[model samples]
Each structure stands twice: as C-alpha cells, then as structure tokens.
Target chain A: ETAVFQTPNYHVTQVGNEVSFNCKQTLGHDTMYWYKQDSKKLLKIMFSYNNKQLIVNETVPRRFSPQSSDKAHLNLRIKSVEPEDSAVYLCASSFLGGRATGQLYFGEGSKLTVL
Target chain B: QQQVRQSPQSLTVWEGETAILNCSYEDSTFDYFPWYWQFPRESPALLIAIRPVSNKKEDGRFTIFFNKREKKLSLHITDSQPGDSATYFCAASNNRIFFGDGTQLVVKP
Candidate 1:
C-alpha cells in the first residue's frame, strides 16, 4: 500500500493561469513536505507542514503557496504561473514529534507544464 | 548557494562493477544523511541513510561512507546491476532536509 498519494498526475496550463496540486498521506505521519524538481532534475524544498503547522518555508515566490487543511493533507497552489514554473512537484511525509524519524515517504509527483 | 553539492552530474558504470557517488555539505548542524533513488517515471524514495555517530553504513550491497569532519559523504553500490540505473540524491537534515542536485547513474550490461 502506498503511504503517500497525489492528484493531477500531470497538468498543462497557459502562463498566468492558476494551478493546484493535492497530496495526502495515510501513513499517519505528522510532517508533510512539498518539493520542486526543475528540468535539470535539481530538487528543492518548497514548504513543510507538521500537524497543520508551518514548520519549514523555503524562499519561494509569492505566487506559490502550500495549504494544509489537516495533518494528513497538504496542497500546493501556484498563481500566475510562469513558463519557468513548469516542473514536477513531489509530496512527502515523515514521522515527527514522539515518533521522530528522518525517513521520508514520497508520493508520485505532479508534473506541471506551462505554455 | 547550494547547501549540499554532488559531483559528476552523470556517471556510467558497467554491470558487476562498483559505482561511487559523492556528496558534500556546508552545514555543520546536519546530523542525518540520507540517500534517495528515483527510477525513470517514478518518485524519489529513501534508499539508505546514516548518522554522524557512524562512519559507515551498509545495506546489502549498498554502503554509505560518511566523513563528519569533512562534511562529506558518499554512496557505493557494489556489484552494480542494470536495475541500479537511476538518479541518486544525497541529502542532509537537522530538522528538515537539504538535497543535493542528483547524480544520474547508468549501468551498462
């Protein structure tokens, strides 16, 4: 059983359009994260949430935002998307707090294409 | 600036040979080091990890050689197989992880 899940496996949108990607984890982990992989395959952290609390926020553009409605769900939204914003976005979860573990379980990524 | 750096953006190794992937970090607070692998059309997953307390960690044929003083670490895949062809990422974590640009490894049979 896959512990982490994501929706909208792929999306193609025009520049300036708004896009949203959804993520959920059934692993009951307290920490969730969003990562961006550019065309060059360079991976970078975008944001992280722990029990719905913002724990780590990278220097991302204002157009990008991470929304976590609960401990098990985290979403990523990009407004006024630019051509350079096209990339594969990955969601991951990890155990924190009392059951702290550094191992991360990642979901199949959402690929975004800006035209 | 990149907190973690990986060299030889790409590597090619013959099957049955040993492959080494290198990594270095700039942060001293990083106590946890983990290596992740992603096959084509697949999401990255945790492959192996190590702590500052140990200089080496081996999982079957995969081993991690860590140098705390140099802020460096490396992953070695022994008896490399075609199935091992993928992108390997090196990362460090305190509370969160900082990943290096992945190294794409290709194994030739």
Candidate 2:
C-alpha cells in the first residue's frame, strides 16, 4: 500500500564494501529527497533532486552519492561503507511549488547495517 | 545548526485527552510549516500543515496553531487515542524543507 516504493528494505554488509538502495515514487512529484536517520532518530537531509537535476547536496561524506534517472526515481550508492554508516535511509518526494509549503511523501525506508 | 526545534522529546497522555506538541523555528523566511507523524517501523506521513498567512489550521482531530510573530507553532490532537501514539515532526521551509527532532507521544488507553 506504499505509494513510494523502496527495495532491499534491510541490508547488511561488511566495512569497505559497497551498497546501493533504490527508490521510486508514483505521486508525480517533481522533487525527491534522501534523508538519513541516525541511531539518535535525527533526520538529516543528504540530497535532493528536482526533475533529475541535483539541487540540494549536503556536506555528506565523499563515499555517499545519489543518482536520479528520472523524476520518479532516486537511488543512493555508498562506495565504501563504514560502521558509522549504519542507519535508515529514507526517500521522499514532494510537489514543487513556489508559493505553497511542500508536503513530503516518504517510503518505508531501507535500513543499512555495516559491520 | 538546527533551524527548527521541538519541545519535550517525549510525551504521554490518556485516551480522550488532548495532546499538545510545540515547535519553533529560527528562520523567518519559513512561511510553511508541516507536521508529520510516524509510527514504529513505518514511514512518516503528513498530519497537518499551515502557512504564515493563517494562524490556525484544523483537520478532523488534528489542528495546527501558528504564531508568525513568534515563529512558533503547536499541534493539538483532540480526543487522543492509543492509535494516535507516534513520533511527531515539525518541519519548515521556504524552498526546501527542514525537519525537527521528532517528539515521541505515548497515549495510554
């Protein structure tokens, strides 16, 4: 029943390994975002894409990268996973409007575990 | 560097009571405020939202009280039920949205 779909709901890998997560939205929202929820439950914006164009990219580690092939898809890839990289990565989409406040739609999230 | 903040990291209330959650932001340019709630092992969803033009917005049992002058707002859940227990987040944005530390609410039946 999720409008936003994510694959590999849970993943586990050793340090120095690579990992990837996929996300897709059906709401037709032009803007999508990637947020990381740490152990402390703090949600931080990592990246955002509007119509396949990178708009907001936070000061994330170099190992982390985001790819968007279309407006409905946004993917996250970690080149070299670290122990501290264990967290919930959430994909969200929102309608782009200049006058109105954006309301976000989110996926179930992919939980990453690095050893 | 937290622009939006929420008070009382956690709260508890009885069924049929009103639960209030408070939030404040530092950015005056943030005209839109949206409150989202997430249950355990689930994704967060929008509960209610408001703009600076209006001081209050209500939807069924959920309501958002906004104060543009103080840059503060509160979400009031009337007739709280156990099902209403979840983590509530306050967010603000002009172009892009920023989230606040969620407030965990526990409603006892």
Candidate 3:
C-alpha cells in the first residue's frame, strides 16, 4: 500500500563524494518533501515542493539541493557528502486543503552512510 | 524555532494498559494535526489525525484528544500490544508541515 517510493535504500560513500536519491509518488499528490532523520531519531525538514515549485527550504547546507521534474518526482542531491550527512533521507507526499490534508505518506527512506 | 513538540522521548507500558503521548505546537496558524507511527526498519504512516474544529477524533483503539485553546494534543492508545511498539510522531500543518521529534513507545506483554 506504499504510494511513495525511494531509491538506494542504503548507500555508503566517502566524504566529498556525491550522492543522489530519487523519489516518486503515485498518489497524485500536489506536494512532496525531503526530510533528514539523524541517529537520534530527530526528523528535520530539508525541502518541500508544491507542484514542482520549490516552496519550503529549511536551513540545509548549500551542498544539499533538491530537484523536481514534475509534480510526481522529487530528488535530492548532495554535492559533497559530510559525516553529518550520514542519516536516513525520507521522502514524503501529501495533498493540500482537503480530507487528505495534513496526512503524509512516506517512503521506506534512503539511508546514507558517509565514511 | 521548533513549532511542534512531543513529550517523553521514550515510554514503556504494559500490555492492556492505556498509553498517552502528548504533543504541543507553537504556531496558532496550524489547523491540521496528524499522528504518524513508525515501526523499526519501516517508514512512518498516518495512525490518526484531528483538526482544530473538533476536540476529539477516534478510530478503533486509537484516539486523538485535541485542545485548540492551549494548542496541545494527545494520542491515547488503549489495549496496548507488543505489535503496537513504535515511534509516534506529532505533526502540525498549515500548507507546510512541521514534525516533532518522535516519542518511542515500547509496549510490554
């Protein structure tokens, strides 16, 4: 019953390497998001896209960037990975202003391990 | 500033007992509240939700009690079971969503 999907369930890379995580949602949602969860289980929002338009960008590092091709596909690319970037990157989707509002459907998450 | 906040970073409860998870938010503009649960090694999914218009929302054994005046909410899980053990997240939304650090719940049988 998962409508949101993520690639590279687990990736291990060294510092200064580039990593890209892809996400797609088939729920016809108008919004998508990327969240980083650290080992402490703290979930922090990185970016949010509404209909392929960048809407919310938290205080993430410049090395981290988000891309959106359409309303269904959103991707995260880290230009230069760091030790602090080793965490689970979760992708989620939701609809705005309706019965389904405020409910988020999340993917399995892409776990990044920086060496 | 952290808009949404959850209490008891971790909790342990006996089976068949009622487990209460508390949440509060700083933004009065937030109108939607949803509680999501995540099991180990799995992604989070919506467990229950409530809006400011209603003070309570219930579904089976899961119930959400909301307080618009104090901007606080609580999720009560009754008849707790081992399978109910997971991390519960409280979130507030106003077009943009904000999630609180989850409360890890452990139900002992």
RMSD after CA superposition, every candidate: 1.6, 1.4, 1.4
Supply the TM-score for candidate 1. Answer: 0.96
Question: Which portions of model 3 show Cα errors greater than 4 Å?
Answer: A97-100
**Fnat by candidate, in order:** 0.56, 0.60, 0.70
Best TM-score among the predictions, by candidate number: 3
Global fold similarity of model 2 (TM-score): 0.96
Please identify which of the two predictions, 1 or 3, would achieve the higher lDDT against the true structure: 3
**Best candidate (score: lDDT):** 3
Range of the 10 consecutive residues with the lowest summed lDDT in candidate 1 chain A: A95-104
DockQ of each: 0.56, 0.62, 0.64
Q: List the residue pairs that clash in candidate 1.
A: none
A1-115: candidate 2 lDDT, tens digit per residue: 6889998899999999999999999988899899999877789999999899999999999999999999999999999999999999999998873225468889999999998
lDDT of 3 by residue, A1-115 (tens): 8789999899999999999999999999998999999988888989989889988898999999999999999999999999999999999988862235788889999999999
| Candidate 2 lDDT for residue A16 | 98
Docking class of 2: medium
Q: Which stretches of candidate 2 lie over 4 Å from their true place?
A: A97-99
Over 4 Å off in model 1, which ranges?
A97-99
